[model samples]
Target: MTELLERCPVCGKTDLREKLQVQDRSVSQETFTIVQCQACEFQFTNPRPDAASIGRYYESAAYVSHNSGAQGLINQVYKVARFFTVRRKVSLITKLNGGKQGRLLDYGCGTGHFLAGAKKAGWQVTGLEPNDLARADATTRVGQPIEEPSALGTLAPGSFDIITLWHVLEHVHTLNETLDQLIRALKPGGKLLIAVPNVESLDAQHYRQDWAAYDVPRHLYHFSPASMRQLLSRHGLAVRQKLPLALDAYYVSMLSEKHRSPERAGGPLTVLRAGYSSNRYAAQHDGQYSSVLYVAERGA
Candidate 1:
């Protein structure tokens, strides 16, 4: 067995603790360890898999496009529903800032679906995608060129009015540097929206090591609301809103369970029941299940 070796990327802490150990799609066996910086409350993955190993998992066909097919009917409906929901949210935010006339950039835009949607809604849209196939798909789908993060240097500083990282923050190798680039690209008062799995949610606690969101080596950072706020504050961005968006917890639970025991295939009824309970819990409580949508703004 190969021993995992890594250091805390956030607080420069070498002292780490094992949080959870589980199996994942990328590795035969994996451990999700959370290393805490005593100096700062910052916690991140230690002994994380190298970039090559993690990249193999993402490059697979299973991850090429959004896995809409893996979801059930209700989940599918929600996926479609979110299109309108996201549009409305963006529209409201843009309206609040005057109108949607400024440039919008979507980081990690897989196949450029959201960017296409944003363009249709009247925002000038651009995208950054690392995967070649995904980037090609985005170019075809959005009918515009999608650039890698490295190419971002060509654009003038402080040019964008809105920037989005929809579930892309966790995969970044250099979280601070990536965020710095994003922040530098945004004009003063520009909005930056980020959506990621909430480590402090009920689903996280229930699944623990088997949590799908941890995603082992793929997800380098597991963010709580407080941690995310601190990260933004460090970069001169003020967190304006933290909305708990309804996510398909049942599906996530299914994946987590499957990752834990690949041999045990969960039945449809069991998955449905879990999903219902998760939805009910989220509805009753304050968005405590799956994911969170963060809205922040650059300070003058």
Candidate 2:
């Protein structure tokens, strides 16, 4: 079953324009339409799979986040990238929190890598993962019990010092509801670190419909810097900083190339060229990274 939204989920605007159509390359291979809100410029997959049926789309062994043991060239590369990035993520959180360890929550913490890293850095960590397999894997990795998404509502208000969502926000079904809970759970001056793919990046523009970041049905919403600001502002949370995940372009470019027809696919050299170009472009233009990490804080 699928649900067709009548209004923009971010702003409740009824005016939406068709942006483009992309296929579910990972699972169903069914084509889905991407629509943009005329007012907010937020893009989303229209008539996406409903909450009850959406789990099927994520059941593939290739879904690296859920299938921690997934093996393949791409999955292996993703694991390697994660290995280096986790330390940086922990360092960033530590720096953001005045070099002190505090209570942290990793939302949608796939396989608990970040949670494990943060725990090693002396932060009390809680992980929330919806996928049962991923949650189990995370529990083993972090050596602690991982909670389900439903646990967010049960948390005491203003309890966490920092909360993070790494490439997870776009996959959320209840955007506003989830944000509300996260906000309510954050202590005053707490930070929300959200990393999401930038739909406005040079690579996304170059690939157009073939952009791998636009993983349809699974990534229900596509966010640009502008749209992200507007969405966060609605909850009285403002972006404090925007940092680029420089390594993402290369990985995303690799997938984007594979998404193109075999005859049109460009291999390693093409992937490197595309990744370098996107990063260079973003260096010259503010808020144009392939993937942006938004550090947000609640208003006074």
Candidate 3:
């Protein structure tokens, strides 16, 4: 069953305007509507499947993160990208800590890739994943027992030095609740790293409603850079830095073209051209790429 949200989850406002309708290309192929809050300008999917029913939506072999099922050419590319991205994430966290290691908690750590990388970098690592299949895979990969999503609240307060959510926060059903738990688990002055698709990016603008990153009900929320910052600030967190993920423009654009037209999606040459164009535009335009990594810190 699906639940239609009446109020803005972020602001508790009732005034929302319908922005666009997008179909889930990855799985069910059912169309969902995107709505924007008149008060906060935050956007989200309405009439979305509740947490219970939503798991069925992600039960696809193509959802690579949950399992090691790298089937298609796209999945193959995703694995390669994930490899480098995990290393980069560890490096970024190391840099944030002035080349030192600390306790790190990765929220929604898919398949234990980032957790494994962080562990190798000398940080005491822990992971929380909701998907049972992914959690089991991650456990084997990390060689440690990964906690379930239900374990978040049970964690000791102010126990972690850093918490990260890479392309995970948007999929969370409990926005404020999850953030609050994360904040409590983080020590004062610790960092929260979140990466999400930016609706205001050049590639997003070009793709419009067909942007693949707008993964509809699965994404739940559409966060522009400003909206992200605002959300963080509201929870007593401060944005310390913003880093653009250069690689996502290409991948998102490719998926977008595929979403736009199956024929366009099938043509290698067409996908390459569209991705190249989007990447070039993003690289030149003030660093507003496809997705952004926001480095936030809790105030002491």
Give lDDT tens digits, candidate 3, residues 1-300.
Answer: 898889987778899999999999899899999999999898999979999899988988888889797688888888899889889999999988778999999999989989999998899998999999999999999999998988999999999889999999999998999999999999999999999998878778888888999997799999987788788887999999988887888788777877876554546676666666666776787557788899999888
* Regions of candidate 3 where Cα sits further than 4 Å from its true position: 262-266, 283-286
Whose TM-score is higher: candidate 1's or candidate 3's?
3
Spell out the clash pairs found in candidate 2.
none
lDDT of 1 by residue, 1-300 (tens): 122534454555566665555445644454456666555555566666666556665644355244433355544654676667667666755774577467888888877777887787778988998888888888888899999877766677899888888888988876888899888899898889998888766777776777777876677788878778878887888988877666447657766666555565566676676666766776687666577878899987
Sorted by TM-score, highest first, which candidate order results? 2, 3, 1
TM-score of each: 0.83, 0.99, 0.95
lDDT of each residue in 159-263, candidate 2, tens digit only: 999999999999999999999999999999999999999999999999999999999889999999998999999999989999999999999999999999989
Which candidate order results from sorting by lDDT in descending order?
Answer: 2, 3, 1
Estimate every model's Cα lDDT from 0 to 1. Answer: 0.72, 0.95, 0.88
RMSD each, Å: 3.6, 0.8, 1.6
In terms of TM-score, which candidate is strongest?
A: 2
lDDT of 3: 0.88
